[model samples]
Target: MKERKIPEPKPLFIERMNRLIPDTNDQKNYWKIVKTEPVNTIRVNTMKINSEELIKKLEDYKWKLIQPWKNYPEILIVEGKTPSEREREILINKNLAKLEPGELGRTLEHLLGYYYIQELSSMLPIMALNPKENEIFLDLCASPGSKTTQAGNVMKNTGTIIANEVSLGRMRILASNLERCGITNTIITRKDGRSFCRKIKEQKIYFDKILVDAPCSGEGTLRSSPKTFLMWNPKTIKALSRLQKELLKSAFMTLKIGGEIVYSTCTHAPEENEGVINFILNEFKDKIEILDFELPLKTRPGLTQWEGKEYDSRVKKTKRVYPQDNNTEGFFLAKFRRLG
Candidate 1:
């Protein structure tokens, strides 16, 4: 089979992003960063092994690993040339965890659940969630089990996590990853995340914490998944914004009073970031409040004004991580507390 060709980013997408980022020089830097390949990175699966042990094990294989951040010690930046197919399989067969060409998915360490090949930025929301032992948490859009498994590790496999994914195929993959990682506290469910409150009304289940990693235009993932530009448009962001708001509502409803919810997306579009958070703030002003949190990486505050429209001033507490900021994908994250 022929290798797939990555399509050039669409002009409209570029124009809209350029407009969103007012700094011309930074915009130029972002363009240069996204068009090139992203760095290869992974997180140590603490459930299987601690970062110290993993680093020593990989070092034996002649791999150099750099800790991404002092705050995020489990994440490591891998430095190496892309391995040939034969070399990759050899490394995998040896149970070594290393970067593969095209960021391929198959590897023995992955099968053995030693580590997870996650993007550096994609791991932030779970970190923000800060799952603890014996707490009940909900992952509204958990799929392929990256965050869910990470949550299990954070909980020390002691808490119950409802991992919900609407798609059957993705649910299967999520289950597989959970099993591979020895995550036993999570209960898998297939359902529309927006309908959870209504579907489980009789049960009256409430979570101590919730994560709504809503689906969006994925504008920030252009470096890893270049085809995002092909499917991206202002209209798509508009449509997903409605769905995202509904999902946020369901998460808030299912969260116990005083529980915290982390809402995140892989898009820079303000409509899906500050805009959705603003809508929730207005709709649930008396019941919810945005909480300020800090990350080790540099981040821009959530946009207060976009396209001449102003957002809730409190939305400024939300954080935006740009590609240029940390050489990672663009991501938005906000933490909310149920005040009622």
Candidate 2:
């Protein structure tokens, strides 16, 4: 048996990105930065433990931990490799500990849900949403439950959260993570996000804040999931953009007047980012306004022009984080508030 080799990005995909980002030195730096692996990052589950205690525990293992974001001490970039076999054997022999997988998740802390392993940029959408206590919230495409869990944490289990996933297989994982994180404030639902939002809106259930983390081609996640390149297709991008626009549309309709909605995706495709936002801006016109938010990491404004197609100037309020921008996965986030 032979190990399969990973595939590289399609030439068309690379060409598209080059044109989209079209700066000579930036293109060089982007290529260089994206080739390297992202450092392991974990967000300490504050529902279970304090950041200081978790930092102390991990540092005892000689892990050099760095919290890269301001005022967010729970986000830790773990440096140094996991314990080697020799070191594990010594600990097991001396402390009567059992042999275990030498990975970050194999620790007692993780097993107890003291922290969650998530990509750095993956955390941005929740931050952009700025979840609050006692607010009705919905994670439109919640699965694997990272953002859902973060939203629950921010609300401190005070609000009702609807965590919806279309896939039965993914729902199980979402449920498990929610339970693992001890989040009791969420209601898990299985339905297509667009239909689910519509169904709830029909019942007169309006959310105070909503997060439509629309699915996309995942072009920005090449650093974490290189297989994304193999799955990348121009046709797929177009299909996803359609679904994204619908999802955002449904979420906006379900949001109460003066409520906020955040649209985010883990792809650099302008079709999925500014394009989708543009659709909503036109669809709702004066009823929706883009809200600008700042981040602690490096990010660029959303493009106003792509391939000579112009988007609403307000789309520039959207934020784009490239892999090289924060040494994290590529991500796009835009915030909106419903107006009467």
Candidate 3:
């Protein structure tokens, strides 16, 4: 397949970003326009039903199940028209008049807390984390509980999860989603993730696994919220990069020796993706090892070969999912294990 051409940076955007990251190349392209198809996905509550039984039930209803993710058995990919159209079609076809606005809201399974409406690609990083039963997990910047809920489902509601979000508004949304999904193993904390780490410092409350799904400039989410581009500027990216590095450092500190941390972002910017990871690796050299992970779907690793700047060799283990390749949001995920 030919490489999908990334969109060039707009002059206004370049001017703004250059002010923030002065040496930023005028030809640098971080945003890409690709056709995004909305996928209505659900994770079968393994606490409620097994994958086979869930598949059988959906098949009986004539709903075609796409391939199952390798690590997450209860999670299934379902095809439909994009976004609102797909939800409308499902309601009309199934005669689900009372269904709510979100994906899978009207489905009997969703009402019964059998599944959740998550973007298929969004589920990748959490799946890669592979939360195990009885393990203590921390979602440093978790909000709206997408990945947090996925971790809960993976543990089958057995372990404890610290779902921390800085904003009270997004925390409420996260709490509601967890409740709807019947997730009870999480403690919702409304605190800046970095401060939370410091507060718990002496408690020795290190996590078995920590997920640093840090905040980005929303460059990758432009397709979902195109209006974001209206405010897109390099200054925003630089500021977000600094914030990401700090959050990641705190996440690293909270990780138990020999534990793993999964760093991910929705943006395609190297400054936020590999650049942040490289900073952590350098600060904690000889104390962390990158893990290799591959998805069954087609994707690429970080563009380490970009420009003359060399990325850490460990970047090869990181995964990059493109909007054009996956028909989902552009994302980057890297798994790292602390060496004791």
Local distance difference test, each candidate: 0.85, 0.87, 0.75
- Count of clashing pairs, candidate 3: 1
The lowest-lDDT stretch of 10 consecutive residues in candidate 3 is 26-35
The residue pairs that clash in candidate 3, if any, are 17-234
Worst 10 residues of 1 by lDDT: 95-104
Candidate 1 ranges with C-alpha deviation above 4 Å: 1-6, 81-107
Maximum-lDDT candidate: 2
lDDT of 1 at 332: 96
Global lDDT of model 1:
0.85
- Candidates, ranked, TM-score: 2, 1, 3
Name the regions of candidate 3 deviating beyond 4 angstroms: 1-33, 52-63, 68-72, 81-103, 305-308
Q: For residues 1-340, could you state the per-residue lDDT of candidate 2 as single tens digits? A: 1122457769998899899789988898777766666668899999999999999898767676788876898899876544666766766343223223347788888889999989888889989989899999999899999999989888999989999999999999999999999999999999999899889988999999999988889888876677887889999999999999999999899999999999999999999999999999999999998999978899999999897889999999999998766678889999999996
- Estimate the TM-score of every prediction: 0.91, 0.92, 0.80
Candidate 1 lDDT at 25 equals: 95
Q: Tell me the tens digit of each residue's lDDT in model 3 across 65-144.
A: 77566655777776533224555666645422222335456667767767777776778878788889999999999997
Which one is best on TM-score?
2
For residues 159-273, write the lDDT of model 1, one tens digit per residue: 7999999999999999998998899899999999877666765489999999999999999998889888788778988999999999998789888898999999999999999
